[model samples]
Target chain A: MSSSDLLLGLSQKALQLLQEDADKIEKLIEVQMENLTTRQCPLYEEVLDTQMYGLSREIDFAIRAELIQESAGKQIMVKLERNLAQLYEALSQSKE
Target chain B: MSSSDLLLGLSQKALQLLQEDADKIEKLIEVQMENLTTRQCPLYEEVLDTQMYGLSREIDFAIRAELIQESAGKQIMVKLERNLAQLYEALSQSKE
Candidate 1:
């Protein structure tokens, strides 16, 4: 394979892995949203926060390593952050 | 550049980036160790733990993206963990 092809393959793989991690976090958010009416687990927020931090670190590293574009990483993070924000908003409303 | 050369360059860059992160954590550990006799910051341990977690996530992503070997990632983590353990041990002893 050519050098470009090699780079492309690596970049694609990196993005896919990051997306998978983001999906996991998204799932966490969805589960919390679904359980909004039920008694929420106190530790779920902490768990989600930690997972988000971990995923952000991964995205940053991938960008530094040139495995993925910075914008691509930001896009993944932005989507998650939005979901996280909604989850928090819902949680607060539930508390009120 | 040839594909092999490209892969080699990417792999080396990934290793270097990971090492840089690990070094920062090592510095954190060293600083905490040095300050063990002084009044310790209550948040230092939590900060160190968070940093370690972030670095581990980066290393895991690099390995998954085929930028670095699994053993290479593990080696970086193990070295930092050992130093972190030493710092915690000193902290505990000082508290006793």
Candidate 2:
């Protein structure tokens, strides 16, 4: 394979891995949203925050290593943050 | 550059980035250690733990992306963990 092909393959793989990690956080948010009216694990917020931090670090590292573009990483984070905000909003509404 | 050279350069860059992050955490530990006799932030341990988690996630992503070897990543974590343990020991000793 050519050098460009190799880099392309690596970049694609890095993006896929990052998306997978983000999906896990997405799942966590969905779970919390579903349980908003039922049982709420007090530590769910903390767990989600930690997971978000970890994913952000991975994205930052990938961008620095030239495996993924910074904009691509930011897009993934932006999408996740929107979902997280919805979840938090739902949680608050349930409390009221 | 050849494909192999490209991969080698990327791998080296990934390792260097990871090492730089590990070094930051090491510096955090050193600062805390130096302040052992002075004011304790009370949140230093929590901050350290969060930073460790972030670094571990980055290392994991690098290994999965094939930018670095699993053993290489583990070595970085192990070395930093040792220093973290030492700092914790000192903190505990000072408390006593």
Per-residue alpha-carbon lDDT of candidate 1 for residues B1-96, written as tens digits (9 for 90 to 100): 999999999999999999999999999899989899986999999999999999999999998898899999999999999999999899999999
Question: How high is the CA lDDT of each candidate model?
Answer: 0.95, 0.95
lDDT tens digits, residues B5-86, model 2? 9999999999999999999999999999999989889999999999999999999999999999999999999999999999
Kindly provide the TM-score of model 2 when superposed on the true structure, using C-alpha atoms: 0.98
Write down the TM-score of every candidate: 0.98, 0.98
Summarize candidate 1's per-residue lDDT along A19-67 as a digit string, tens digits: 9999999999999999998879999999999999999999999999988
| Candidate 1 error regions (>4 Å) | none
Looking at the true structure's interface, with contacts defined as alpha carbon pairs within 8 Å between chains A and B, what fraction does model 1 recover? 1.00
A6-80 in candidate 2: lDDT tens per residue? 999999999999999999999999988888988999999999999999999999999999888999999999999
**Structure candidate 1, residue pairs in collision:** none
Q: In terms of docking quality, how is candidate 2 classified?
A: high
Write down the RMSD of all candidates, one decimal each.
Answer: 0.7, 0.8
